[model samples]
Target: MAATLDQVRVPRARAGRPRTRPDRVLADKGYPSKANRAWLRTRGIAATIPERDDQIAHRVRRRRRT
Candidate 1:
């Protein structure tokens, strides 16, 4: 996916290199793993995805115990 993003080209009016990286990435809960989120963060891209139900439940359970 990173490679694909790098290959993207957007024409500009002034004349310069095309846009390589996107400003943000929107994905579903299935794509919001720790590694995936870390990867997107490292690339300076914002990710807008909700946590999975299981993850949310686990967090809530843990919080209650503390």
Candidate 2:
């Protein structure tokens, strides 16, 4: 999916290099795993995805344990 996103080229109005990357990406909780978030971060793309419910619960449980 990232590769496919990189292949996209949006033309510029003033005759410069077309945009090869997007400013941000919107995704649902299903796509917000640590690996996916890290991958997007490495590419300098901002992602607006909510964490999974299980992940949230795990964090809460871990905090309580600590």
Candidate 3:
């Protein structure tokens, strides 16, 4: 997904440089890994991907322990 995002080019409505980064990314659970999220954060891209079931469960367990 990161590789795909790197190749994105958003055409400008006016005469200007094309956008290299997108405003946001909407993806499914398959793209919700920690590395992917961190990469998007560093690049200032917003993600709307849902957490996987195991990730959610792990989060819940960790919260309960604290």
Candidate 4:
């Protein structure tokens, strides 16, 4: 995933350097890992990755307790 993301090159309209960081990433649940999400967050990239089933269940349980 890191290798794939590093290869991204979005050209500028006027003229300049290509964008290394994309505006957003739409990935599957399988791609939503703590490391992956943190990487995108630090780069200020928006991600549309769904939480895994276990993660969702854990979140729900935690919420109910509070």
- C-alpha lDDT score of every prediction, in listed order: 0.80, 0.83, 0.93, 0.91
TM-score, every prediction: 0.74, 0.76, 0.85, 0.77
Model 1 spans with C-alpha error above 4 angstroms: 1-15
> Regarding lDDT, does 1 or 4 come out ahead?
4
- Candidates sorted by lDDT, best first: 3, 4, 2, 1
What tens digits encode model 2's per-residue C-alpha lDDT throughout 1-66? 567677888677797999987778888777887888898899899999998889899999999984
For residues 1-66, what per-residue lDDT tens digits would candidate 3 score against the true structure?
Answer: 989999999888899999999999999989999899999999999999999999999899999994
Clashes of 1: 0
> What C-alpha lDDT does candidate 1 achieve relative to the native structure?
0.80
Model 1, range 1-66, lDDT digits (tens) per residue? 456557767566688986766778788777878888888899898989899999999989999994
Model 2 lDDT, residue 12, Cα: 77
Q: lDDT by residue for model 4 over 1-66, one digit each (tens)?
A: 788999999788888999998999999999989999999999899999998999999889999984
**Top of the candidates by TM-score:** 3
Clashing residue pairs for model 3: none
> Per-prediction count of colliding residue pairs?
0, 0, 0, 0
Provide C-alpha RMSD values for all models, in order: 2.4, 1.9, 1.3, 1.9
Model 3 reaches what TM-score against the true structure?
0.85
Evaluated at residue 60, the lDDT of candidate 2 is 93
TM-score for predicted model 2 compared with the true structure:
0.76
Best by lDDT: 3
- Alpha-carbon shift of residue 28 in model 4 (angstroms): 0.7
Off by over 4 Å in 4: 64-66
